[model samples]
Structures are given as C-alpha cells and as structure tokens.
Target: MSALATVHVVVPARNEERLIGRCLDALATSRALLLAERPTLAVRVTVVLDGCVDGTAAVVRRAPGVDAVHVTELSAGGARAAGVARARDLEPDLDRGRTWVACTDADSVVPAEWLVGQVLAAEQGAVCRVGAVHPELGPAERLLHLGWLARHSHAEGHPHVYGANLGFSLAAYEHVGGFAPLACGEDVDLVQRIRAAGLAVVSTGDDPVRTSARRSSRVRGGFADYLTALAVDLARAT
Candidate 1:
C-alpha cells in the first residue's frame, strides 16, 4: 500500500558477538510492537559487522529477523553509512520521504516499543527522535549509572541524541549527510548538525535502550570516568 510507511533499523557492530545476539533479539521484539501498533509500518533490521573477528555475522543470520552485512573495515561511522546505504538499496520501493531509519549500537538492547515509539514521533512530525540509553548493569553499578544519568540528564537541550538510540526519517538522515567518516563522536556531531540545520530533535525518555556498563567498569573510573570520557569528547557539541 502506498500509504504504508517503512522503518529500517541499522546496527553497527564491532567484536560484539556476545551481545549482538541480544540486540537482535530486542529488535525482533521491537518488530512485534511496531506491527501491532502500526500495521502499515514495514520493518527491517540490518546488522553491520564492523570488521569483527568473531562470529558476529553468524549470530545475526541466526537471529530470527535480521539481515546481516559484514563490513571488512572496522569503523563505526563508516559501518553505519554502509548499513544505511544498503537498506535503501535493498528496499528500492521505500519512500525516502516517509521512510524512517533507527540506529543503535550492536551492544545495546532496545526496548520492545522502541521502533513503535520512534514511528509515533515521526508521524507527529519529529525530524529527529532521541531516546534514552539506560545502563544495563548490576544493582550497585546501575545505582551509580542512575546517579550519573540524573546529574547529566539535564544536558538534553538540543540535538543531544546518543547514537545508541537515535532515529530519523530517510530524508532527514540524508539531509544531515548520514554518518560521517569520523573516528569518534560522529553521533554527537551529526545530531549537532541536524540542530544547526534547523531540524527538531525530540527526546523520548520513555523508550529506553539498554547498554552495557562494561566500559565504565573497565575505567576503574566508574560511571564518573565513563561520563567524563564521553563528556570530554561530546560536551562542546552537546
């Protein structure tokens, strides 16, 4: 049907064999919610393995409803660009104007309603949809991350979407040049560009995406250290 809208989910994975499966599983669950709420919404998941040495491609193929794309060079931004391009090419009939794209890291697990929520926002005329990234941690670690979230959550002023849970219309994505070929901070940079171009970025905290807190643990710096690292990199842009 011409009236049907399409939404593609792209995940850039690098050495995430252990967690990519969970992310794909969450996407399958998201597909269910989208189908129930927006029957006219077509859904597809593209998992881009960013030069992973592990069995990331195998894991994605095994996932119930994922189309895996293995990118030989391991660059997050580059992988995302390739993935989005592949999505558009694979589904030639997709309406670039009405089609929406959702991006998340392979290490993150989206909520069941993630896609549905983003679609709803897009339908409401939101050009850029930003969702919260909650830490998937043990009780103590979660408490620490929560405290960090509370303290830094107010940083949500404009174009402050995390790559872990971001969505935009195909038109909007292309308008922002998709993901740039940068080594880091491409997400923050892209969102900032979106805002600079006068597009609205709506944050939907209700739809939380779960991400590992291992980076924080590895820092021995804990949540503060992790936040400091990202903040040092993204604070100016945010």
Candidate 2:
C-alpha cells in the first residue's frame, strides 16, 4: 500500500483569532506523532478561513504543517467542503481507499493522538468515525451541562455527531455528494447521509476534542447557544 494511508485534516474558521493558534498547534503535533509511529502515513492539514476579519488567517499562514484557504462567503459546511477539495488536490494520486478526510473546528483543540486514533480505527475497518467534543466550561457551566448530560449519556456506539472531530474515507465522502451547505447541523446532516447510504459511521470516545464554551457562538442555536439557553432555563428553575 502507498504509505499505509493518507490523511487530510480540514478546519473551518470564521474569526477564531484567539483559538486558531492553539488548534493548529495541537493538529500539527498530532500529525507529527502519527508520522513518528507510522512513518509512511501521509498527513495534510488545511485551515479554511471564512470571511475572517481578525488574525485567524495570519496565524494559520505562519503555522507549520498546514495550508490556508480564504473564501468570501462560506460558512461551516461550505468552508469544509472547499477545504476537502483543496486538500485532495494537494495529494499526488489521491488514493480513495487510503485517503481520509478529517474535520475539526478552529475553536477546538484536538488531542495529540487524535489523528493517530482515527487512523487506527480506519485501518481496522471503520469507514466513518465521530469523536466527542467537550466544552471548555466553567464551574457553573459544567453543572448546567450536567443536567443536559443526564439525557445524553455517553454510551457505546452513541450516535453523537460533531464536525469538530469527525473523519471519513475519501471514497465514501465523494459518494455522498460531499458536505451540504448549511449554517449549522451540517455535521449531523452529513452523518445521516452517510448512514442512509448504508455506510458505517461510528463514534469513538478516546481523545475527544475540546471546544470553546463562549455563549456568543459562530453559528446561532449551536452548541454554545444550547448551553446558554440551558443555563437560562436552569437559573429560572432555581
């Protein structure tokens, strides 16, 4: 096999000036770690900037082991779709069987073993893998999320979907017509589509991504807004 596998990472960032560096650093480290273990495994990262007005692009441009792509009017889904295409184009052959497309948000930091874990799963026959996203919350926010967790317990084979920490085979992705253009819930939409096509989309709890807990989210009614609304409701109940 050519280099065991080739993994491409895609990150969608709008104005993540504060968090892009950390995110990129973590990803760069993960790539190095994976290469160290499996020297033949190829890896590439693309940071897709969507109409950013801050230093997100600047940070990514200087970052090692990553490519930057700027777009005028792209959100979460469109940005990632654009990134996927760009990343694949960089590869010499773009072997569909050995190629993997992974995604994480610019506001999140993946673990050092993030990419390695995904590659392991893929090597063991996992077509799609979705990792968990833990918000960097404070004491109050943690307690608030506790109630939300009661109903959303992490169990084996849980269908929790998040674009910030998900990956799929190249062939499977193109087969699904690529990612849809949605402001939010694009991750879930893509997962559902993959499953509907009779593909295996499973969850892996190891080395879950750490995301921001800011109430003012990039996408309205997203994870951040969900936490804000929950906090409001809980405070009212108390």
The best candidate in terms of TM-score: 2
lDDT, candidate 1, 1-33, per-residue tens: 123378888898877888888888888888997
lDDT values, one for every candidate: 0.76, 0.84
Quality of model 1 by C-alpha lDDT = 0.76
Q: Give me the runs in candidate 1 sitting further than 4 Å from their true place.
A: 1-4, 154-159, 216-238
Top model number, lDDT: 2
Candidate 2 residue runs with Cα over 4 Å from true position: 1-4
Score every model by TM-score: 0.85, 0.94
Per-residue alpha-carbon lDDT of candidate 2 for residues 95-197, written as tens digits (9 for 90 to 100): 8877888899888999999998888878777778988888787775667767667645556587788889899988888889888988888889888888999
